[model samples]
Target: MSQYFHSVTLNKEKCKGCTNCIKRCPTEAIRVRNGKAKIIKERCIDCGECIRVCPYHAKKAVTDPFENIYNYKYKVALPAPTLYGQFKNVWDINLILTGLKHIGFDDVFEVARAAEIVTLATKRIINSKKLQKPIISSACPAVVRLITVRFPNLVKNVIPIQSPMEVAARMVKRNISKKMGYKTEDIGVFFITPCAAKVTSSQIPIGLDTSLVDGVISMKEVYLKLVPILDKIDHVENLSCAGMIGISWANSGGESTALENEQNIAVDGIHNVIKVLEELEDEKLSDINFVEALACTGGCVGGPLTVENNFVAKNKITRMAKLISNTAVNDISNTLETVDVSWTNPITYKPILNLDNDMIKAMKKMESLEKIYNDLPGLDCGSCGAPSCRALAEDIVRGFANETDCIFKLREKVRGLAREMMELEGEMPPPFRKNEE
Candidate 1:
């Protein structure tokens, strides 16, 4: 309900005030203070890196409970493609789709179907418009938010397309409402999410004013619920709508593969994505056609909320993709053309990292920040409760901390005090010597 809706949150009681999260955070949104981790609302992209790194399980993603589905007259389960990869030895996609219905859903929808549509739409956009080189994929909400926060200059390069999850939610809601003669609000569309970023996206959409999805459920929770009913279904419905190409979006390089662009590159892991984005920002990859940047290491399958190991999940997804018929891609692509899946809303830049609202003052602050940074030890040790020495310098300039907060600086101060005490002791008169004389 805050200005920014974040799925990731901290449990203050469980936090040990460790610097693990502060250092790993891609956007540097986390800071440790008062023996707890605090998320900066404006800076947080909800990438779930903190949740992944927290040793005490203090960081958690807020997801809708399974029982929340009963609040609506109808419920639709929108499962991410990564959901299919979570199960072991389950090559039959239909079994997983049917499993959701058995687990208490009125209907099931595959976000992968929408991914296929996005692929087609993206290809058309790439071929039609003289788009900026290395067009960034908008599929990863975390990556999109990262650009909005840190790389405003690269916002224009983001492909103007809704994510597969959003598209699928819209498509499912519209189709179900029309077919069943039910109002949009009467039906609840739940996205079975693999990561916190998708949960945040469902609640506070980036480009749009409102999200089509009604709720989000974590994959880890859904996996637990669905496993008991996975193999018990008497009738496996033929509800597999997405092809292998679409389903392949679960793993790294899958989107680029679907786009079929020779010059496209797919990079995963938030840190690696940052490096690639920096290179792209420098115009080093001007000849590249597209950049598919996923925040997790192995794409959605490697989401912090997932149960399966990312590498194992990727292998499972690859095997399943290969077993499916090749013609299914064309079939799904054709069906997607009939749906209104294009993104109409505009994305605005968020200057969260801006030093000040005033241009002149901001410049002055920047100069002062650099001067402070140069004075501090360049070691990126997080002893100051900041990610790095540079971050500590920035915090000092922003009035959040002082240079003495640095352990090395504090050590020097302590040494100076000790030296002064020693000198004073040496200069002091011998006990009662002057009085006796």
Candidate 2:
């Protein structure tokens, strides 16, 4: 069985067998083999790092078709706050929300609205001081998956909370069902997402049994459709209710700022997040109260599925927050009562480091792996398809690669064979020997 339902995929036809993806993957999940890059599904967190680095456009994140929204009798669009940063001149979020309705959506629900509600709930959780110190934010599904697979020891450090997308979807379904007499199943809640991770999260949720989100559509697709009709729309709805704090979640430190905690640290970009998690796992940051980690560089704006430049998008988000002059719109403490915002199950560790299922065999494999690693050049040149020498050594121990797969090793083997042949020539039978005479 596939360990994770991955939204990120490889286009073998477009791959150039370059080391770009394999070199950059934080999890070392990618390898160039047979002139094509391969993704180890269990190790891939769908962070879209490979998608970001591929020059040949071989790595792509697969989202639901835009037409998939039409499956239900009623369709509701859940627009992420990052969607606000895509447009250049449009400052009002209401125009963006209304534009979705004009483009066949029955209604629109702002995911940022749910973000505001989650912010309030998070503050309460922090004040309660119930969770482990430096509680990691679970907003980024990619980061959560990375923790589960790579940083398994820090699994308990993640706060158990439903994501804003799920909260928004649940809110939309509940409100529509109650007001319009539409059945929950008849209403389609589609998230206009900024990242590939959200697509996988919507399809197969982390902490919940099933996600309330019916479908996930990319922001780039929605942006193309919105551009044509945005200039024509004469009226805008009063649908932009999410305030400054929630709106700021589009940027790197937005969530940490929302908590209003001076002791908190917010780090973005997958690599940086990994470093921070490493420190946290080592108990170095005992003084900190919260850790807000976003997988994308400039947070959701830097996501592979989004169209805008990350810095430009980040600036627009800050400007938009001030333009609207919106405070936390409403006290969402009561909203938490109406909706289930916490996790349905505990987020458990799913370690991918073990060499085997059997303890003794795994120990032997580790020993062999270490020996192989010691023989490697340690250049991490990625010439052997794997991301690093250690990774190649691991592959060798696992029977996926040969020592001679490495150029240096191959050269050494060639030299050894030449010496052996020279030695054998002196001892060969006279009839089989090649003699200058």
Candidate 3:
């Protein structure tokens, strides 16, 4: 039921079994075992905090290869707005697009273009909704997934619109197919993404099942292949695919400004977003009209796949914003009309919690699991293969692990077992061997 496995993986041999990742994980997703760290896939949010903190650099995200472009008759590379920051002095965005051509892509599509549509959709929703203030952006998959798992109460605040990457893939396929006289099936749209979350988003879109994207290549992989070719591409066109509103999607508060809302607030970084979300839950932030919360600081520029310094990339994006036209998101909606913008309905919109389609069964499970959780060590050491002590208890109730399997509790039980065994032995027999030896 997971969209795709986008979490960081360990090179078991390289892992030093350190507790650094365990302490840093928001979800307590890593556990040290047999002198190596193991990932709890179901609990991992794919935020890549483990990859960032790992001393040996044993953690790596799996990405699609560039050769995947050949899977279709025609291929289009949809680069995330963050990909632009990977280069130095790359004033022209088309240089990177053309560079994709040199690297084997037949065509290039900007995810920023799709961002334009999302910007409009979100603005429309914000303006039209009769509900509460502080509409949350659903563009960042990690932030979205975090809400689904940890903060289900805020789900209604999440604007239910397709992410910019999805929109770009759909648009490019439709427009290019129409322009080139080819069928939609003949075109392959690959998103050049910034993190594992986007890869997961492409594989399993939240509100939809089949994604518009055909494949995904991370920024880390793309940068390795494109660095040498960046300067060599001399015949690049001036793409101008996205305006300021679209380009701003790469940074913090980008969506808020794009929507032209005066009362909105934007916060970046996972901890910061969590604090704001907590405030939202308490109804303390009810006055704000919109809340743009990104799990990564500096927005997509700080995503795990990006190679450039976050501060440096943020500056570059800021500088780039000044050169482009400052078109509002409302203006960009006109462009989407010509493109085939239909979406597969309700695929990504299901509730992830099994909580109580049947309330009686769910309540009984919760009560039994609550008692088990109370007995746990609360260390969240991940030794039992669940992410945390509470998660381990849930797993026990779910029938994946037994309550006694927790190493801390097991050691305690073993001590009690030893005492019981000694008591059962009664009086001990005298030794036959000589004590002088």
Candidate 4:
């Protein structure tokens, strides 16, 4: 495997070297070089912001092919609540689950049901009053990665629970294999994802060593297959086993609401999430007990890989939750003993900012970076390809960029060279001088 696995990638042929993506990237992971945008794998969190902002359609996400589900003898689908929002006028979540069986899947497990299990675990942790204050939610893979790369000090503040996707996969694998007398290898659990981050998270896990999910299929890809088959189905199965609290997870503030904690705060959008983390670093939010951050605006419904408009999707999810509120929710109080929801490994800070391993060498490089930054124009015009003037300076100190890459700095050197050329004309030898007209 490669050193770093990223689902969000660049299409060089379609790229126009536009600075649109660099300015919007929360991690400053993109840079235009040789007239095309490039992703710095170490800095990328796979948040899908670049995929949303690129106008030329140059950025795209990598997902498993739809046919991969047939590879297993018994194929199961773990459909995220975000998948329900992609369809129009679907009053029942069970209707959507039945549609999956028509195309290829033999069985369906609602991720929302798994979400309720995670909710119960989180409330238990909050009651214990252990660890640091203001526990961070680990539901969004992009937000967890953002903390590791940018807010290193807040790594400990993150909750150590596995996401609902992982929980759902484990549940499906265990139940199907044991009851059917099939080997674990023969069962394939696939997650229907709505974002690029989930695609990478399933392959290269955040807090776990290996993900139980066998594959990840995009919601957009599945929506295409379900559109024609939905109206044709004769009967809908009673497969959905989640309540309103679990289904609410499709939109922002859903997780916080389930906690029933007044001391918590919820924030969405990648940039807005950064602002909240910065405040937490400054010790401004010590009074708050929990911080719920999601990379995409409007929660999973706003993911770039989804087909519906964000506003419309959010409304659909709200309506669907209410439509099924009368149905009883599955009680997951006994699931903790059956499946492990807590992470086996701790989340660690990814050291991308270090200039060198040696302290003295790193300090010296910091000094050089500051000196170069002071010399350049402070306007972060993106003309030099880096996100900001300081980013260009850091690139120069790292030997990836030259000082003259800045347009203003290059202009200064050109003017100085022109003046010297005129001065040298006066001292040239008679033979070397141009003949007077």
- Candidate 1 lDDT, 71-185, residue by residue in tens: 9889999999899888876778899999999888999988988888888888888988756767999999999999888887799999888899888988888889989998999
Positional deviation of residue 91's Cα in model 1 after best superposition, in angstroms: 2.1
Q: Candidate 2: misplaced stretches above 4 Å?
A: 1-3, 327-330, 422-428, 431-437
In model 3, what lDDT does residue 224 have?
88
Candidate 3 lDDT tens digits, 1-437: 55347646788888887767777777665666667877766566777777777888888777777788898999888898888877887877778888888888888878887888877766667678754567888788888877877776787777777888888887887788779988898898998878877777766676666787988888888888998988887688766578777787888877888777678898888878889999998899778888888878788898888999888998888888778876564556676566534334432323434544577988988998899999998887766756688877776776767877799888999999999999977645567434534
lDDT of 4 by residue, 1-437 (tens): 56589999998999999899998999889999999999999999999999999999999999999999989998999998999988886777888999999989999999998998898899989889886888999999999999998998899999999999999999989999889987888998899999999999998887899999999999999999999999999999989888887888989888988899899999999999999999998899999999889999999999988999988999999888887762242358778778999999998988898887888988999999999999989999999999999999999988999999999999999999999998986777777778745
Q: How far is candidate 4 from the true structure (C-alpha RMSD, Å)?
A: 2.0
Candidate 3: stretches off by over 4 Å: 1-10, 29-41, 130-132, 327-331, 339-426, 429-437
TM-score of each: 0.94, 0.96, 0.84, 0.96
Model 1 Cα shift for residue 370 (angstroms): 2.8
Candidate 2 structure quality by residue, lDDT tens digits, 225-289: 99999989998888877888889999988999988889989999999999999999999999999
Q: Model 1 lDDT vs. the true structure?
A: 0.88
All models: lDDT? Answer: 0.88, 0.91, 0.78, 0.91
Give every collision pair in model 1. none
Off by over 4 Å in 1: 327-338, 421-437
Error of 1 at 335 (Å): 4.9
